[model samples]
Target: MTYNKRICVFLWLVKGGISVVLEMLGHVKLALKCVTERERIERK
Candidate 1:
């Protein structure tokens, strides 16, 4: 039972970590887009 519990916890942690990474990546992509837009306006 303890072994099963450990596996469950591990899987849950992995899932959570993946979601956090994905969220960070999305934010980074959004920030990059905003930066490019600002640069474009500045150049004009």
Candidate 2:
């Protein structure tokens, strides 16, 4: 029973970690996109 509980906790943490990573990736992508747009505008 304790083993099962530990497994569940481990899985939950993994899922949460994955979500945080994905969120960070999205923010980085957005920042890059903004920088690219600014550069393009400056070039024009």
Question: Candidate 2, overall lDDT?
Answer: 1.00
Per TM-score, the best of the predicted structures is 2
Q: What is the C-alpha lDDT profile of model 1 across 1-44, one tens digit per residue?
A: 99999999999999999999999999999999999999999999
How high is the lDDT of residue 33 in model 1?
100
Query: Which regions in candidate 2 have their CA more than 4 angstroms from the true location?
Result: none
What overall lDDT goes with each candidate model? 1.00, 1.00
Tens-place lDDT per residue, model 2, 1-44, is: 99999999999999999999999999999999999999999999
- Estimate the overall C-alpha local distance difference test score of candidate 1: 1.00
Per-prediction TM-score, please?
A: 0.94, 0.95
